[model samples]
Structures are given as structure tokens and as C-alpha cells.
Target: MKTALTELVGIRHPVVQTGMGWVAGPRLVSATAEAGGLGILASATMTYDELAAAIKEVKSRTSEPFGVNLRADAEDAARRVELLITEEVRVASFALAPKKDMIARLKDNNVLVVPSVGAARHAEKVAGWGADAVIVQGGEGGGHTGGVATTLLLPSVLDAVDIPVVAAGGFFDGRGLAAALAYGAAGVAMGTRFLLTRESTVPDEIKQAYLARDLNGTVVTRKVDGMPHRVLRTELVDALESAGPVSGLARAARNAAKFRKLTGLSWRSLATEGLRMKRGGDRTWSQVLMAANTPMLLRAGLVEGDRSAGVLASGQVVGLLDDLPAVGDLIETIVADATGILRRLASE
Candidate 1:
């Protein structure tokens, strides 16, 4: 179970519970930490004050090392970085590659920078910018994902970067961990698997809905936030795919306003953030407007448990999962099973 990832983060196992927006909170994160894995708190959904309080609560629940996942392009990115430094967080995982100076600042403050990338080139870029490690997620990952499978993408990134690489996307069991290690990765990270666990904050009915899916139950569509998002094939998702652009934009605008109210952000701040998002890529103004749809829609499904009105971000691995074990039991089983498999292979 010990690997570069374990050594790098001071965790006993080379397993990570990913930062799922509504699911990864203090209780689940602390449970993962207590089980000896690196649990990441999802801060993209929280306000600054909420993040601070959640970090404090995690520290109170467990002394083991953990991480916080945030959006690098957020308006308060620098402020969040400072908070991590002041709180002495063990790891800072970014949803996007952070600026070079931001990486330097975090590293100088003794916080490890681990960004999640979807491509080999991105891994190279972040590694060159002084990231301690990178988590390479493939197309099968939940939420926004690329088109490459992990079996192909993981090696491409491993070849492109010298830093430790954690394989993500489509990983759920110890056999997957063994396979990832065999492929030269330091470890594996799981989001959907962890989200189905007993400690996860997601409602039970929702968990059952995820568990009922088969391998072909998920679909990738660009209707969600103008990006390729993998989610369960729900009626809401089907409707989104069939809806016209005009209707989508109208809904997105309303959600944007609601998100602003919930987060206590002014109209000017939201407009500025939207502009920043637009400048970050080749996104059109319509795409930028649609971007506001993600947080509120996800909140409706994940936090409010209204399945008919919301969309559930899920990995294809949902089909293979059927049970909800506690976080501690899940990690222990994965590590032990992986150890046995590796040992048997060596003996052969």
C-alpha cells in the first residue's frame, strides 16, 4: 500500500477520496483520513467562510493528512491559497492548473500542489510549473471529462511527467489499484466509488439510484455547462440534450441569479467571474452564460435530493457498484486486496 503517493502526503495508503462538490464534506473527509487515505475537501461549492469552518471541523475530527480541492480560476483563488497556508493544510489540489507563481507560493509555504489534469500535455505543464504531483483523470470520470480513456491516458501522462501520477477515472476496487500500480502510477483516486460510501452526505435514495445503474447507464453530453459532462441517464439529462439553445440560456440565466444570491455575491462580482471564465478559453458568451447552470443544478440534485429537477454527476463505474460500505472499511479492503494481488503476482 505504501508508495510515493503515500510518502508524499504522509498517508498510510495510496488511495484518495476525490473532491466531489456536494458529497465531500468534513464528515466524509475526516472518515477517509481516519482510514489512512488522503481525503480531499471540495471547496468549489463553498463560500470562503464555509471553507474555513469546514477545514477547522476536519482538523477537529481527525489529525491525519488531507487536501482541499478548489478552482484555480476563481476570483478568490489567491485568498483561498493564503487560507490554506495559514491553516497549514497538507495538500492543495486544483480543478485546473494553477499559475506558476501560485504553485511557487504554495510550495514555499510547505503545501503540496496537486492539480487534476485530463491530458498528458497538461500534466507536463503543471509538472514544469513545480506541482508536487498530478492526478490524471480520464474520460470515464464523473462531471466534466475529456474523451480519452484512463488505460491510454494514464501512461501518456506518466511518460510526459517525472512527478508522481495518480490514476483516476473508472477506478473502484483493489484490482483497479493493482492495475494502476502496474501501469506505473503511484496510486489511484476515486470519486464515484467514494460518493457511494456510507459516510457520504448524499441522500440514501440518490445513492440507490446510482447503485441501480449498469455499465451503460451513464452518458456523456455537452449540454451541461457547455462541456462534456458524464452523468447518469436521467430524464432531466435527456431533456437538456433535447432542449434548444435559447431555452438552455434562459434557464442558465435564472440559475446564475440564484447562485449569486446563495453565495452572497453581487451582480458585478458574478459578471467579473464570468468574464474571467470567458477569457480562460475559446468559450463563447453563450457558453459562458451556460456555465452558471452547473452549481445550481448540481445543488438541486445532490444537496436538495430532488432527482426529477436536477442532474447527477456520475462516473460510468456506477454500474459496477452495488453496496455502500463505510469509508474505513472500503479503504482497508482495497489496500489489503491490492497487497494480496501484488504479492501473488510476485510469487508467480
Candidate 2:
């Protein structure tokens, strides 16, 4: 139960409910926080004002420490960091590697910084730059992911970084928690498992679709965002795969415009964010435009509950998840089981 992550975030258990976009809202976050796990509110899809309001709402619901997941390449990254500092959020998590200065500023304000990395080098980079901890998500994780399996990637990151590393990707239960601890991780971070909980705000229909899936239900495709993205194989995803490059670019353009309007972002602002993303990872201009497709497509399914038109970002763990439990019960059960497993192993 108590690990470096628990000590770092002051949570009773080492379990973490990842900040899944559109799913990790105030209700689920507060529920997880109250359940004694570190619940991170996803802020990439939220406007600056919306993020502040959601943070306040979570604070109103639970006094326990929580974190905000941020897009390190967002145009308003500085302002967001300032907001977190001003509001005194306990932690800040980054989707991509954060700049040294951003990490420095948050640490200066006593906010713990945890960047999710896919490789040992990235983990080492952030660890050297004073990140409080790292969440290493492997290929089995939903959304943007890498090719390495957690079994291999976890140890590589552990060997490279002295800071706490939370294992993610394909983790859903207490047995996985014990396995991660045995792998020398500080804890585990789960996105899909938390998203399927009763406390999650995802539409029931969407949850049902997720629950119906099996181990082979998800697909990893670069068609979604020009980067490897793991999503449940749906009709929309199939169509995307079948589309030609020219057609894909056309769709990306339209969605870029839609996302700009939906988020009230100016063309200049979108361009700045796009350029930042491109520079960070050597992405092409076309890839930058395709990147806009992620939020809108995810919103159609996750927020509007449209299965026919939207795509579901899901981990391979969806196969193992069959029931929806309340956040409190889920956390309690996981903690109890993991403790027993650890005890049994130690005695053996």
C-alpha cells in the first residue's frame, strides 16, 4: 500500500486513476480522491477557465490531494502552470515531456511534477530535470502509446531513474499491482479501469460498449493522430484506416476548424500549439493538422456518447474488465487484495 508514490502524493494507497480525457471529470476525480487514490483531472480538453472551475469543484467535493493532467505543448502552458501554482494543486502531470522551466516553476511552488513517459530515456531526462516522479505507460495503454511491453519497459525505466516510476498499461486489478511492485515500480496508473467505474461520467451506452470488448478488441493505428494511438476497433476507426492520405488530410482540416471553434482558440493560437507539438517530436505539418482530429473524435464518443461516429480510446485491459464498481469499493478491494498478495509472497 504505502510506496514512494503514496509518500510523494500523501495518498493512503499507491493506486492512481489516470486523467483520461472527457472521462476524468470532477465527480470521478473527487470520488477517487476520497477513495484514497491519487485522481488526476484531465485538462488538455478543458479551457483555462473550465480547468480552474473543475479544480475548485473537486476541492469542494474532497479535501484529499489530487493532480491535473496537462498537455505540455499547449500554447497556454505557462498560464496553466501559473493557475496550478496559484490554486496550490498537489501535483501536475504532463502528457509529453515538460520543459525544464515548467518543472522548475511547479517545484518552486511545492507542486509535485509527474510526466508520463514511454521510454527509459524520457524517464531519465525528466528525472534529471527534477521531476518528482514518472508514470511509464507501455504499448497496452490507451490513447497515444509506444511499442514496448510493460514487462520490458518497466524495468528499463526503473534501471535508468532513481525517482519513483508508476507502472501503467494493461493494469486493472490488485494482482497487477503486486506484479508492478515486484517489477520495482512505485505504483500503478490505470486509465480504462477507472473510466469504467460507476463514478465515471462516461455515458452508460459507452461504458457498455467498453465492457463488451475482449482482449483482441482494441487496435493500434497511426491513422487517428499520425502517431500510434490505441483505440477500440470501431466502424469509425476502420473508415479512418481505409481512407487515403489525401482524404485523411481533408478530414483533418475540417476537424481542425471544428476543434478551433469548439475550444474558442484563435488560428494563431492553434498554429502555435501545432508548431510546438511538431517541434517537440519531429512531426510533419500534416501530422500537426491530423493531431486536431483527436479531441473532436474523442468528444463525439466520450462526451456525446455517439458510438457510430466517435472512437473509444481504450487499453487492452478492457478485455478483463467485466463489472463497474463504485470508486471507493474498487480502491478498497484492490488495496486489500494487493496487501494479501504481497504478504503471501513474502511469507513464501
Candidate 3:
């Protein structure tokens, strides 16, 4: 149960509840922290002011340390980092590798930077740039994910970096945690597993939709946000995959406007952020437009409880999950089970 991750973040267990947008909120986050695991508040879906309030809310709920997940490409990344520094947030996890200056600033403020990396090279890059640790998620992870399996990606990242690595994707129970530790990971970070918990703020109906699926129920498609987003294979996703580029762009534009109102960002600023997103890699204008689908589309299902209208991001591990447990019970059971598994393996 005690690993470098626990020591680094001052948590009792090496388990982490990932920052799932629209789901990882104050209640769930505080419960995870109170349960003795690292709970990450998803701030990418919130405005700067909202994030500040959320940090305060989490602090009010639990005295234990927690982290905030940030969007490295957000237009106000620097301002958000400043808030984390001022608020004395314990950990700052990024959806992408943050700029060297940002990483240094957070570390200078005594905040631990833990960027989630999909590839070994990214993990190496962040480690070299002074990240305290890395969460390496593989293809089986929910939402934006790469194509490698965790069994392969975890060791690759571990061998590539000296910093502690937390393995994510397809991890549900104690055996998975034991396997991760056996593979030399400091711990396991789970999204779908945590999202199904009783403390999750996701609506009951939507939670039922997620719980009803088997491993084959999820699909990774670029149609959602011009990225390989792994979501439940719902009719909406099927329509997206079959839709032409014109329809996709139309939906994107509409959602982009909605996002602007929700986040209080000016159109000019939103356009500028889109340009940055385009230049970040191979994202085209249409793909940039599709990016809007993530926040709004996710909000529909996770927050509004409209499963037919919104998308449910999930790990393939959904098939293996059955019931919802409180954050405390979930973490305690996994850690205790993992300890037993490890002991038995050693004795054998």
C-alpha cells in the first residue's frame, strides 16, 4: 500500500481517483481524500473562478491532501497555475505536458507536478522537466487515450523514467493493483472504476448506463473530438462515426458557442485557443472545432443525466465492474486485498 506515490503525495494508499470531467467534483474528491487515496479534481471543465471555488470546497470537505487536474493548453493556464500556487494545492496534474516554465513554477511553489502521459517519451520528457511523478495511461483508459495496452505501456514508462510511475487503464480491483505493483508501478490510477463509485456525482440513470455495459460496450472513436476518445458505444457515438465531416463541424460549432457561454470565454479568446490546439500537432480546423464536443457532450451525460444525448466516457474495465461502493470502502478493500495477494505471491 505504501509506495513512492504515497510518500510523494502524502496519501495512505497509492491509489488515485482520476480527474474525470463533470464527475470528479468536490464531494467525490473529498471522499477520495478522506478515504485515504489521492483524489484529483477535474478543473479543465471549470473556469478560473470556478476552479478557485472548487479548491476551497474540497478543502472545506476534507483536510487531507488532494490534486487538481489542469488543461495544459487552456488559454488561462498560467493564471490557473497561479491559483494552485496561491491556494497551496498539494498536487497539480496536467492533461498534457505543461510548459517547462509552468512546471518549474509549480515545483518552486512546493506543488508536485504529475502529468498524465500516454507514451514513454512523454513520461521521459516530463520527468526530465522536473515532474514529481507520472501517471501513464494506456489505450484501455477512458476518454482521450493512446493505442497501447497498460501491460505494455506501464513497464515501458517505468524503464524510461526514474520517477515513480502510476499505471492506469483497465484497473478495477485489488488483483489489478497487485499486478501493477508487481510490474514495479508505485500504484494504480483508475477512472472508470472510480467513476462508478457511490460517491460519484454522476446522475443515477447515467451511472446505470455505465454499469450495464460489458467490456465490449466501449469504443474508441476520433469522431467525438478529433481524438481517439473512448466512450460507451451508444447510439450517439454510432451516429458520430457515421456522420460526415460537415455534420461534425456543425455540431462542433454549436457546442463551441455553448462552451463559450458556459466558461465565460470570449469568442476571440476561444478562437485563439483553437489555433493553439491546431498548432499543437496535426489537429486541423475541423478537428479543433470537434474539440468542443468533449466538454459539452460530456456535460450532457455526466451532469445533466441525458445518456441518449451525451457521451459516457469509460474504460474497458466497465465490463468487470458490478456494484458501486463508497470511496472509502473501495480504497480500503483494494489495498487490503492487494496486500493479501502480494503476501500470498511472496509465500508461494
Candidate 3 clashing pairs?
none
Which residue pairs collide in model 1, if any? none
The residue-level lDDT of candidate 1 at 129 comes to 95
* TM-score for each model: 0.98, 0.98, 0.98
How would you encode candidate 3's per-residue C-alpha lDDT over 212-289 as one tens digit per residue?
998799999999888899999999999999999998899889999999889887888877878988888898899988
lDDT of 2: 0.93
Ranking by TM-score: 3, 1, 2
lDDT of each: 0.92, 0.93, 0.93
Model 3, position 335, has a per-residue lDDT of: 96
Q: What tens digits encode model 2's per-residue C-alpha lDDT throughout 249-272?
A: 998899899988877678898888
lDDT of 2 at 282: 77
